[model samples]
Target: MEPVEINAGAYYLRQLRADRKLDDRPALMEAFADPRHRRYVLNYRLRTPDEATEYVTLRAAQWACDERCSWAVADLATGRLLGEVGLRDLDLDFGTAEASVWTHPAERGKGIAAAGLSAAIQFGFARLGLHEIAYRHDESNTASEVVARRAGFTRVGPEERPSPSGETLIRWVLKPS
Candidate 1:
């Protein structure tokens, strides 16, 4: 499925093109360099423009697959990359998917992540015919939990993932009203 652009009030959501049209390399690298972003996002630190190019290229490619779709959340006026939001691991039969979002450190506390996530959820439910979306984040990441709750998700419970960090993931679910 081809990804589509969305108007999200102060922000907009568009496909992350690896091409010059979207050219997110510099901004992406800067965000990854932030220690706080590195801790919560796990978006990983990119070493160079080439690596960033590859990163966005892969993210952009996810739209063509059946399981995931991502959008670059940008400031409407500046067109600067504010963050990213996605509906991933989609279960078409079950009408469900997982929501993921991360905002640049500089854009934090501005509601970019929450707004972007809400827009993605709307698209998934309306366009993709999804019934529910799950949001999960590290237990320590209060910011993400706040975003989830603000977007109308209800806390479900804790989930365990096999990882060296002993990560405790908090899970929340949102069903269509």
Candidate 2:
């Protein structure tokens, strides 16, 4: 499949270009390296630009193989990366995937995550023909919870999973109707 882009008014979502080094690497690295946000994502803690580059490489490969999608959420005017929204653990046969989103610290309260995630959900169900799209977030992540709710996700209760930090993570899901 070709790379996908989702337009959503104030911001747009596009496939993460893995073949080239990201021009926004420094900002992205700073966002991912923030200890407060690191545990909520699937990747290891990004402590340096090199680690972030490795992440971009991995995400690029995943996008190329259609195993996952990592979309950059950019401002419509300046094209600044506000954050990212993606689908992971995609199972085409089952028409399901897990959705995740993260916003830059400066972009948190401006509706970036909710809007980006809403666009991603639309892409998953409408474009990708998915029957169900779920979202999972750590229990302590109230911000994620808010984003999920604002993005129209309903809570399916708590689930226990292992985290990179070795703690039993409490996760919740939101499925699209």
Candidate 3:
């Protein structure tokens, strides 16, 4: 994976630039600071530039590989980050990966996750020649379920075990058309 950028309708998906440290600090801090984000996406809230920089470094490393790809969904006009969507646990042999998404607190309810996830699915099936993409999220996260459905993923039932978040894991799958 060479870290592709995508033109989502109201937003674009780009890898969070490792070189854009100054630009990414405030955006990441703002993105991960919310309680909602910490609860569902990550355990720690990005409070300082150093923390945000560390996160950027981690996400940057996820690129330049075949294993995973992550993108920052940004506003078209302002270029502010609206959220993130990614394919993780990629297995080319099986042409499969798990999709994940998170929206900025201020940008919630505007369909950001759905748009970003849809574009990533297209890239997976069309560009990467993947056969299927699996989407799994904490069952308590109704918003993720909505995004999966909106992006045309079929409900594949729930896992018997709970996710790390202590909620049952609901599963969905999207196959290439």
Highest lDDT model number: 1
> For each candidate, what TM-score against the reference?
0.93, 0.87, 0.93
lDDT of 1 at 168: 89
Error of 2 at 28 (Å): 1.0
lDDT tens readout by residue for model 1, 1-177: 888999998899987755656577888888888887777666455879988888787876777777688889998886789898999998889999999998988889999999999999999999999999999988888999899999999998988672224578889999988
Residue 171 local lDDT, model 2: 53
lDDT of each: 0.86, 0.77, 0.85
Q: Tens digits of per-residue lDDT for model 2 on 1-177?
A: 566878987898875543443355666877887767776665666677777678767778888787888888988775677898898888888988988889987777899999998988888888788888777766777898898888887787766665555644445455557
Query: Where's the lowest-lDDT run of ten residues in candidate 1?
Result: 158-167
Clashing pairs in 3: none
CA lDDT for candidate 2: 0.77
Question: Where does candidate 3 stray beyond 4 Å?
Answer: 18-22, 43-45
Per-residue lDDT for 136 in model 3? 88
